[model samples]
Target chain A: MRSSLLRAAHAPTELGMKIAFVTPRYGEEVMGGAEGAARSLAEHLVADLGHEVEIYTTCAIDHLTWADVLSPGVSQLHGVTVRRFTSAAGRDPKFSDLDARIRVAPSSRSIEDSVAWVAANGPVSESLVEALGDCDADVVAFYPYLFYMSVHGITRVRQPAVLHPAAHDEPSLYLPIFQRVFDSADAICFHTEAERSLVEPVLHTAATDQIVLGLGTGQASGSGRDGAAILGIAGRPYLVSVGRVDEQKGSTMLYEYFVEYKKRHPGPLALALVGPVSRPLPEHPDVVAAGIVNEADKWDIVAGAEVAISPSAMESFSLVVLEAWVARRAVMVNAVCGPTMEHIKASGGGLSFEGYLSFEVTLERLLGDAALREHMGEQGARYVASRYDWPVLIRRYEAFLESVVARGRRSEVKR
Target chain B: MGVDGFDLDQVRREIAAEVLARRTSGSVDAVEERRLQRLFEQYSPHAGGVGALSDALRSVDATIFIDPDVPVASSQPAGAAIKKTVRKANYWYMRWVTTQVTKALSNIAGVLHQVGSELDRINRRLDLVSNDTPAVIQLADADAWWHNRASEAVARAKGRVLVAACGDGSFVATLTALGHDAYGTDPRAEVVPTHGDSLDLRREGVIEHLDAVADAMLAGVVLTGVTEAMLPAQRTWLLRALDRVLAADGIVVLHLLKPEFLSGEARPVALELAGVEPLRPSTWVSVLHDRGFGVNLVDGGPDALIIASRGPRAN
Candidate 1:
């Protein structure tokens, strides 16, 4: 009996799903944005919908012991039940070699090694299946990529399963395994429309009915209604670009334009680029890279600016633009990416630029005219509030899970 | 000891000053407070308040007693005679001494020795309660010792429950082999393992009475050495955890380097704080007994190992 079959045999109805989140490591404070997001999502699922949630993860640096490797078992954490799977990564030399190989090329013997390692030292998929067999869940949602080996074992089980694909960057690298996973899953979820497009080729045309869950935006409050004079800008107040230092983020281009625009206009127009610069910038002072900032710091930066600028050519969804809108700051975006264009058209929040000169002019006009910035900022905030918020987004997620569970039940009935 | 170097008269004067200072203050803060507290709590006072004060003063007087420019007392009797004569002369001069000088000298020596002995006991008690043996073993000079030990231990005790005391969940990966019920506790923060589950022992007051908790449980207890010497509170909590959760019939394993032999260029700050003290076998036995645990000495040499069980109660 395969683990998935056993899991399916014991899986509950759609209304009674009890989801167990399995990860090699679990904790909100730990590394990796994906892990943090997963932890946050789990918390929301349990707190709001009364769904049972559990996270399994590794320990931090200080408290490791030998017994952890020897006796793999389940323990409770912050209302979640976590089961640790032991591996020989730290013990056997072969295991270390295998882990290294997997890092270089995930399709190599590393995948086999990981599967074998979990089967031998850590808990097998059977154990998870048996554990779930004891519980009553309508479906199991698997966060894939690193834990890909466990996916096939999970999908083959008795219950329905949903794959919440948190895809980022070029999707081609993972197309092979992702295609298999997509076919196996009863339903799929995408973080952005751009991400959804990336997987469109591999996904069947009929699967368009599958959930295209968009990345939700955060809350927005306070408007820059006091105008540009109170904001302390001397000349034509301009735009601000905020993001981490990455080549794709287009900080260099934003800087070049700012320099040119400053040369053209004598007024106190400033393009404040906040967030850390991972790469070196040319000697340009007006292009202020404020480095990494907290929420309060970002609010102050946005509140004083006439408009928010996003020059990223490949953003799945711009968290910075959402933040700017929340602060009631007018936005300027490059004509790239689906989310940015959709947001601009829907909210009439601000303007978009096809080239550098036009972007500079738009920024100058917004800074010179305080009334225009105010009007755009107010409209942007309203659009963001209605669409985002976890309360609204999570309902969509729940409905997607329900649909997956329902499809699985109907398929079983047909069989 | 020579009379000139070990002057009983001068010592006696110092003792008298200390006693007078303590009496006037109405508290024991004038002396080593921890040592004084232990003494008063442990020993039955033979003398009444005033007599105890006088005896204490007399003891100080006798410690400094010396012959005029003499190197050594001729014999034990002669040294005794000299001490008595000096105290007697002082008593006569003071005109308020009631006890015989010879008896007073004996009483003073006895009290000082008693307090010193009590301090030794407290130090030993502290060591037994807080020593993080498993952490010490994992950190032993051998590389990957934690991983190996965890695997081996789990393989050995497959069906039994394993309790990792004062462990952060890092060892959860290693202990995953044991198929046993594994739980961890740390007073500082809840260490939720990425691979396994961990209960926050702080909420259960496990940190406060770790020894009792460890002793009461029917599971094997593994203490991960988390710089026990640096953290006094963790040591206390671990000791209590071991005492409470460790099964009576179960083995309590610890891995620690003899404090004197700890390698890696010694940290001046840690040394100043932790201090260097040789771990003695007898010290281990005595300390464990004090914490309601019986000792079964295991591997030793430069690095020490011990397996202790809940010992017969003192009462």
Candidate 2:
């Protein structure tokens, strides 16, 4: 157990410690998952946890350059101090290797190019190193490690650093670089228990101290747990799948199965596929394709659903599943993904399927038995409240930071 | 002639004294005093010699020339007679002044009408410069008309395209079409991304970009109403895309709503917002110029019909 004194000392004072968050992209320009996570976490850290947090990221246009080497330059965003290094898209020698790869396979335009740009630019230039030398910050945190500027900037600063690896896929591919970065950090954080498990194999030392942080979702105050409609039945009752139309997201299987199931159930039931139609699907009046819904609309879909289906084969963690649990909707998951299975086992929120028949049978059973669905949903919501709320997750994060900082300080003293 | 009537001079003096008393006392009665003073001022100018004499006695009245040749007895008895004659003369003078004032006012009104007509002409010319050339101005007028027409058409067809062609991509985005696709082609390709999938522009290397874009396979294409102002070559490409690429049953809609006024010969610059660059109309027309499209005025007016078909046939 870490010392209570250490914990109390780390308890953020009312004055609040200054935290600089570094990312490849921040604000409204790039509306990706990492951007969403950074914004949500930053808000909670500042508003709920009593920390003054500012995010530093690169501009969409400014490719990496030697000129970005200056420390602590301010960004046009919300008065947050941002030091922008040129993007890797430009001609810089350090990124020559990654640029070679990109030239061969140019499909992944933005992310890979940015990483190469930062690597060539020597992370933060000497001038930017001098600038951060002047800043008064207790900690610098980096979110989702694509930005080389962030990795370079924080590592040189000698401040307690927290690296939150938001995604856990391609472990062997991407984890080694992160593992080294994490080793340098005072603490490491992951969003889900499943993510923590993936990293545990690499993290031989200090595995226990590294925390599994819960993602903060928007306030679900207006959501109700009961009386959602069952739209359609494939094998037994209606099951709905909501997600982007990608191969990784298994909506194709659902659509194929739903077509078969429609023949068996002669009654009026709906198997709605609500999400952005990334690819065109054949028109079916029975299947309501509510495309690209906003946040409120997404929650409404979840709340109105009897069973929320997640067939993702490659999700790091299913935010949609978490949302379904919050709405007290029955979550049906494919057991292949580490995060989905772990969440289901831990929360008892929903059923997981090992095969197609298992998914169909479980969905059928849930549909036929309303009592079982209701009880499971209740259990899920309670489990989510106990494990995933901001207060519970933020405390774990604070403790992990304290442990890291204490260990670092003790080591420094011994030396 | 009316000595039996109440003494008007005494009444005037009494009212004035009361007003002074009220004002000096600082009573709320000061409001009443002000009201009474206004009444006195309005009626004083027309008041007979009795009030005039009272004004003179108070040293507030100006003196007028009097004929000394007139006998004292005649004047004294004639005072009543004089008052009657003076009243008659005053009435005639007032009537003459009223007629002259009416004539002057009518003349002023005529001048004002001429000025107003001149201002309207100037305003119309200014509109040609300030309002007409702006793509948004013409777009808004066309869109409103298109919306009403499209709504009726959509109700009948159930599945048809509501094609809107304007330099303003954002406005085109707001139109309703069944399986709707809105195309706003411009030399500026940068603005295309902001309006999402439906908004597409013709670029310098459009053939290559189109091939790359078509590799993704869009569901439908919308050719909004075209204008003759576009360069001849670009119109040919548009026609080609329409005939070759557009599905056989796909509908092509056009808008020709004209504005009541146009801002003549005014160059309007697009305003830049955060994250979005401004694109001018000339920049938009250049797309057509490059594509070998020809625009003809459908009606004998400034309005035009943009005929979209296969590329222009060989001469």
Candidate 3:
């Protein structure tokens, strides 16, 4: 009883070095790349570096609907303390109206409209913002800047704000309200330098301390044999596209382009679209939509394909491209997607397409030369091995976090 | 290989040339870039003149007249015939009414434009009277006899130290070289990092810098340049700012010119414009004592370095 009373009086010392993450939605099953990246980072920081980790998130399971599926309260998930808050709103119709106006002319919108739009967008949990005020962690990290959790949590907390802005070149990034979000961050974390280059000048935060940390890719798995069989197709030359097969991911365009390519070539070349199909796919004899394959199967399909393609024009970081490289496969990317284009340009393991013509030309070249495909795949695999090995990434992350904590935002005193 | 070492630029160039060579038609659509507006900043009138708003107003004034001869055609054949007949019959009256309306509108626009010009003139004259900006000074001595002593005391201090009016940020550099977390604020923009520097230096006046800082945040503050020509009112404001922002255990290092030297012939031309010179070390001692600080003085040729510690500092 005496020991329990003592523990109650001095609680912080019991929980070693404390750190908290404020992500919009978090779970191993969560499909959003940024959310999953945050979860992976939190788990690794706890298991590898021995930092006490806490995840503050909403009860929403699906991002688009933001439906509160899980019960709100504290629980343990994968050895980390998880606090789930109920969202104040679900789907706000006004958000669409405001978003449409901002989309037409994003940079000129008033800061008031930007604030209203951010609040209008769902997953607004008042309890989460309140809890951030009471938190006594060494640092609070708010991931993926578009959500309401980051917009409110970073300003409410007294500790240093580390913003993991999984940002892309989108209209919402130009909103005036994001200036405050960028300025409030004691240190900004970016997934790619390309993302940094796009966001840094929005609020003149070039002098702000920052780190570019890409998510770690898993080890190579599965052989290239049963991938074609799993798709219910006979062995033939096929190109695979990974990630959410939705209109936003450029799936519709890929479909149209692939059909046209097959029409011109007049062969048994096929296209296999992978990952969760958010939108319905049109039926075609040459096209296969195998949605949400397991990790091993995903790698198997990547290994089996002639060229792994990411057709999306908007991406902050393309982890799928790196994964394909790990599986020793050549990839194709959209030229305008800054993050994926950065990856392809850096790796020399992929080709980029502007439109149908370039796509046709690059595809024909890669398909015609097997030796060229092998060389590109090997080059990409080597690049991934040298740059994104897990152990080195973790060490660099841990060291950077320690330095930030030690530095104490003392420079902010001169502001 | 590191991705940085990859020769992708050469390949990208090759692809660009190839795509351009194969362009047989203008079928490839032009990608329209989205229009963007810069962040809004409020316009303030200065001594120079008015901004783009005045130009826009002039443009509107020049185009306010009604064109009266707008075509009377309609898309429908029957409607077009009827509208044309009516417009011909009423053309004389329409021209007379439009001429009067245009005259009134044009006159209003011209008057509005004239009022804007008058306001611009008044604002420029007001600016001349209100602006009493300070000149940047390079008077702080980086190699004073007490440089090591001041740096040692600050290096052993507990929290962050600020060097106010740190010309060229030399004192800040000295403190940082000794591993003390130090930053400086100078009135001169050239003294900041853009002038071949890498230190933490902000371009702001001493009081402007302290106003942004949270209360009780600094463990130490080293002051220079700003002390020599401050008015009595500014000195009081400075003391209040210092008392608020400095921690209870904080120390202050002031590099001031000797009263005798300030009164000498070699004193700066800038100081001659000031109505009041700086206080002596003894006067600062009495003034700082009332604010609960203990003061000590160190001699450096023609200057006095006042080291004031709040109550009793641990270091």
Candidate 4:
């Protein structure tokens, strides 16, 4: 499905072209999908494609607070330069109050009120906006449009702007203000077709200048025993879920399902979750919550796991699913998520279950038949190799950015 | 032993032999050549074929949990294994052919399915707006009720009111008689009163005329029988345009024609108005709200009126 889009579009050129990426937050510690993707793309562009890439971001460590955790300075990661600026307005309770009001009592809010709400919803960096206006680059990309940084900075971007909205079925996207952001962009890049579908209706047209250029993954091929040792769950076979372990991410449903699975089929199988925990985990003996793992350990755990379960219902793109594929693990994803379902269907890499019955069936099948699991994992690995390896994917990324540059040049000529 | 007893070297040898045989027979076509080119392009980045295969196998072993007691192969750096595999797997013809055929078939099927889904989406959107209509006319009663309603509505209105899609200019005449400055705009140029020194009715597109209106100039808009005639997209445009021209407190009264009053020319006109389809009153109201309109639905048996005002977040 994605191949056709790539073939249809004009190919990009790789040279000394400079591209600047703008995001609300930027750091290795930043655990969000868009941030990670931005860092990956930025570094790869510089290292592999021989392009001059710079990142313009706020000096914030956490998205929840948008506070200046990192000192404002220019730093380099994998040859990509990252210049950070402090957000003039950080997090406030009023922004939360206004958001709640907008959700609960939409009628009470005016256009001005909504605009104010967006403003008060911090990461409102005047310096970032100024930097966008002054940036000298062939192309500037603003990511994950929910932020005040994107909403404010994207409009100010002087060069050709490509917006990676990273949008899902969320309330804030429904605001009328985002319409302008969509209109102002030179090109819109989607992480998945489902994200495109979600944005297309709001924009009133299937965007012609859009591409579903998925992110790349660094493949993991190590034993899970290393990860198992780190988590102190060395002996038992376990299925791992890697991400922020919270209820909003359907972690609660996953926990309940795992508990039920344990009861239904008694075995040495344990559910080991490794990530930052936002909510409390059940005190069940079979479940192990390994809090805040480093990248290497995370990959090791995933690599050694029996299966990878991702239960998030709202996901623009599941990096964990791609990572799981890279690790050669069959994944059990929530059937409700668009990106995960689409990925599963395209790769034939795993099974998806919407309810307890399907979940049980999928788990039973994986546990009972080792060959099927192996086959699925192999299928997924090939799919990832053919599509998402940085060596291959960087070309697509370059092509897309080049296409935007070409369009920008043409429009400039017309003017 | 290979990883999990899966011999990567044997698979590579089999592939290489198949490719060499095919090449020796001069059987590789342009399509086959392209497929092989794609395969090399995809997998050539990594160090060695065996190493790549080992990496893939490692992923598979970790993912597919079997009996740990099942003796697994000892670890090799895959450098020697990779060198042996790639050297032998140069003519891996069978795998390449299978991948190419599968990819082509999948692309074709996916394109067709996508087209079918797009058509389904359009059909579904049309269904959301389309309302059931009768075959023949019964507008005499409806026309009378609209005349009285327009008169009452205009009398209560504070400023100039525009009646969009006014069928015969009779409703505009009725509003003018009720001591209100009422102008009627209809799409059909021929529908204008021939004997007009009168400026009450004009043959103009409502959207164009509304666009020409000064911002916040109109005190009210009367769109009684037009919802059935307008496409969902056009209705959205009309509402947005109406929003631009309407005063902060301006009201729009949409007198939705009864499904029963639709017939012959009028019913077919509503159904067949290029891309326009009639929607249920409830659907229209929902659309109005989505467009930031504060709406009130007043039920009047077969005919209904939707009184809408621009909400705080109308823009």
Candidate 5:
């Protein structure tokens, strides 16, 4: 009883270091790659590193409307304290007009035009900006470079700001305003080496301040047989893809590729998709859309699969691919996604294809040769164990944060 | 009027200071927020309501100034004439700017075209120079390891020695300079600069040309660049194929990358060779052993050098 009381009263080293994460959207309902990562990392920072964590986010749940549906106040989510503020102008009807105008001719736009574009692009919350400025935290991390909260809020905060810019090679990234954000970041944490390489040439920041601290994946358990039985596919073999079933996530591409694969080579192999289906799946005997399975079942499905596919070309860091590797499953990824391709190249745990021909060949090789499949799976498991295990990743993250804080303190002393 | 008598500058300065303070406060205080709202309300109504009045004044001005029907003798007609002259001057200035911009763009395009052609010429010259000069092997540093290996292979074997995937043919040139009958083969020979014409270098596949060599005709074969790029099956085929042309006592030198030196991110150039997986030293040994070759490793520290001879083959 005494020990427990002491533990509750005086938490150990790095325990009281408060971190505030500013993302455009937050909560369990919000299902974006960056949001999910931010939430998970924040929770882990608190639970594992013993740090005090909070999130400052807009009251909007849906990214489409950035409306303040949630109450504008502080609330407890899991363990972290979430402060939700109102968006003064949420999703203006003329947002698309401004977006199109900017895209049509970005170079021709004046400073006022760009400013108006940012204002109309929605989720422009004066209150949120004020909250970010006033919030007292050791460090504030603004997620995803695209959102206005990250683009604008990051500069306003007095605390040392770290930008977890989930950047991709898109037209919006070329906007002149982001150049300042990237340049001003006290420390930048990238999800992958490719991401760092991409940002370094553009930002030209010192290497010491930028770190490639990839997210960790949970370990997988349970046999393939048990997982297959749980999914009601006891005997049938299928290729599983887990994520949002949308065109942007490359679900459409995966569906089309599977169709072409079936046309060329008819077999008992099926495609099992487990995610939030943004688009309706076409009726096919071989395709099964298991929408939003439980987390355990999702892991089970991954373990049961013959091969896991990640077809998205615009990924910053594919956590799903790492999960697939953890399940000892060989993965096939689109060659264009820098993060996934980097994973494949580094681990030699999976195969990547540029086109359908390469895909067909790689797929046939993995499916036809059981020994090869086993070898690749073993390679993947080893890679995940060595690099992505949570404990190892958490320690690295803790050390990186400690160093960043120390550096900030040194600069503060000098000031 | 009283409005003109009012000190508008003082009011503007006071309002600007109030807004700046509010913004810097980072939070809305109830009393201050109401004050700020009232200040905005005081001026927000008339901010954009002048459109109709401005349009009417502009029309009246245009009729008096730009209209050709206005009498030039009237006092107002003098202002109209001056306005017309100013409009024409502005139009001419714009036209001059447009013409200059067009000329400048045209000149830039011409220069770019010239630069493109020059680049093309340089590229062609580079291709020729690359073929004529030895290609720099961008891998492990060149040391006495190549010289020692070449000399050892020549001394140990009889008949013509072939070096496969001999990048740049510099090693072949070295052997030739030593008066040993050494020939090099590189599929990308056009890109790799070579020594003088006396060096026996061929622009073809090492395997395809090796098939043409007479049995027991070649004393030694040195395989390098493409060794790590072949699948285990392909490597097995290569060794078996070598047995057909190579003398029973001839030695085959396989230069592979040391797996210890390899990092997860350092992609060996050989990984791009289609239909192949990167190989480790152990895999090379097993592959060589499977094709009836007794293995001998030459430890050049960083390099994975293996010498293979015909022996009891592993099935």
Candidate 6:
């Protein structure tokens, strides 16, 4: 990577500095994408760069419930200090009602209504904020812009605030209260260019510095096998989709399309839904509802498939597509998904489908040609290694954080 | 190997065009699910006809382990104590039973794996059956033809140069003698030279060595012997790794075996073990060209000697 993002980060700079990440949830078991990403980044900061890192989060596991289930206290998770505070303001009963009002036209909502909506969104941990206010870390990263930990807690930190804002194109993003969230941030980190485009417009006054510092992929491992013992689709060709199987994630759409495709194509191509099943899946003979498989099995299923499909269009950055590419599996993505569409086009690793007709055509094309699939998968893998490897990301982040620290120092001098 | 010069964008365009053509042909969604699924099953990466045999073996190997430990406690107070006492009393019996079960299970699992040696011999013979082309046996040459050319090509290489498949480290010594910090890796144990340790000659294949190497660490590479031995997938991985590890100005000197060397020759055991043929030198040149490299085919004779340098796409 001659003109690499990491090239600037690799240049002479600070060696090690204390970094803190404040997220709403924290742990491997906590499957929220943003929280998991935060954990990986924090761990990499420690392991790869030898930086002192800590995580300040509410003891909340369930995103929807916002209940403080995990024991509240300082603990070591994956070699990083994770300080969990009991959720002060849990999800309010009136939160859904208030959220509904703000959901329709968030920009037009009253400041008071927006603030209430945020608080009602809950996971309001006052103790975590109080701790952050006195913390000695160089900078605190408040993850995923929608959360109270980021919106409210970012203001409480003594050090420079870096907001990761795992921001997606959603109604909650336009809330009047978020103008301050972006304004108060020292530096902003975005997941993808598409995400940056969506959120930057909402920033009336942007942060001092910002970067599309995306998430890294797990270096591909394991040989994918026939789904005989794992998914019971032994010797059967399968199309695997990894991630939560839900309506919002577009699994329903994917299922309908596959069922239609199988009818049209007249073949025994099974569809494997590999994730935590939230909604009821159909009892079709071909659909293998593998629930939530382990990471090894997930890779195994994905690698073994004729094609891997990322059905969701709601992604900020589809890490699954990168993962599939790493495993050398060709991918099919939702055409409307800006970030995933961008990835497919840029990498030429996969195809995107607008609907059933497009899906039918793309799936057939991928299934028929082994050489094309292999080429595309290799290209995707190359894209991921060049752009989103942890080493590359951590270096860019190190440089970004260093600048944030420098800016903070400058601001203090001005004061 | 067959699908040379395959372009994804071109393929996508063709697919789109076909889809459009099919749509124009008024093809309706009247296909059968059961039949389509069966056809799909055959196309699965897992079940590629005889390749399914490999999958079955992998499956057997993966599932062979029989974990012996099981929970041996009781919920009731007396029940737990009684169980513990009985467990202690029958410890020898329990150990014997577990041991026997484990042994039995292992023996069953080893039923396939035990024939590994026989399978190797069978596989070597099968390679000849599958591919009847003659192989040209190239013995290790201390004064190899490409040594001087490689030595000169990487003269100004910024960092250490790697001489892969350096049989007896002669080429590596030649480069080191020429003042280039050259190291080598060869898997053959008998080829261990007296100064192998000092020369940084690791006992592993180049691909294995490159897999663990830090990105953009190598200044130059000299590949020999093992290039033809690589499987198609391994070849792709080697290219990717070289792209990642080789510096911008890095030169790669490839001493590829002649493609005319086929399976019929009284070949080395390693050649039979490799179970593959050499890719055409032109194919390598074209691949390197496609990947944005300044390729120079120094000698496309008895054994093709190509020198390639990173081009503008060295990212």
Could you say which candidate leads in TM-score? 3
lDDT of 5 by residue, B179-285 (tens): 56577767775745532233445554565556445455566788776565554555556767687767767778877666556445665544542434457777777
Residue B270, model 6: lDDT of 61
Candidate 1 lDDT by residue in tens digits, B1-315: 222233323433444455455446753333333322222222111121112343344335433332232233446767867866776667545443333554666676778777767867887898775543312222443233444554454343322234334345544434533344344544433443321212212111233224322123334555444333434556555566555554455445555555655545642344444543434545655666678665555445654455565434211
True contacts reproduced, candidate 1: 0.00
Which residue pairs clash in candidate 3? Answer: none
Q: B108 in model 3: Cα distance from truth in Å?
A: 31
Q: Which regions of candidate 1 fall more than 4 Å away from where they truly are?
A: A1-17, A20-40, A56-138, A142-159, A166-174, A192-194, A220-239, A263-284, A409-415, B1-315
Q: Over the stretch B185-265, how does candidate 2's per-residue lDDT look in tens digits?
A: 433444334213223322212221222221112223333323223233443454454444333333333434232222334
Error of 6 at B164 (Å): 48
| Model 4 spans > 4 angstroms off | A1-15, A104-110, A221-226, A409-415, B1-315
Ordered by TM-score, highest first, the candidates read 3, 6, 4, 5, 2, 1
Give the alpha carbon lDDT tens digit for every residue of A1-415 in model 6: 1123332553322456778899889987765378888998998988888787889998888777789889999999767989999987788988878866765557777778888888898888878878887777777888878888787777777678888887665667777778777767766787876776566545532213466767888865555555545889788889899887877787877787788777767767899998877787779998998987777787788888888998886787877888999888889987657788889887878888754555788887888889888888888888888788888788878877875675462221110
Output the worst ten-in-a-row residue range by lDDT, candidate 4 chain B: B42-51
How does model 6 fare in lDDT? 0.72
Which stretches in model 3 have alpha-carbon errors above 4 Å?
A1-16, A223-225, A409-415, B1-14, B25-315
> On residues A53-153, what C-alpha lDDT tens digit does candidate 2 reach at each position?
66665544222332333233456444343555444333356465754454332433454454444455443334443444444456667776544544555
| Residue lDDT tens for model 3, A277-354 | 878778999999998887778888888888999888777888888988998888889776778888877778988886
Evaluate fnat for each of the predicted models and list the values in order.
0.00, 0.00, 0.03, 0.00, 0.00, 0.08
lDDT of 4 by residue, A1-415 (tens): 1122322342233335778999888777877568878888898988887788889998897656788989887998778888999877787767767776665333334567657777777777889888777787788898878777777777777678888988766556666666666667767788876777666655532322556778888867454446667778777789999887877677777887788678768988889887777788868988999878777788888888889999887788888998898888998887657888899877878877654545665677677778767966887898788778888778777877875775562121110
> lDDT tens string, model 1, A217-302?
54533343432332334344546777755454666656665675677666566666677565757665455566665555566667
Recovered native contacts in candidate 5, as a fraction? 0.00
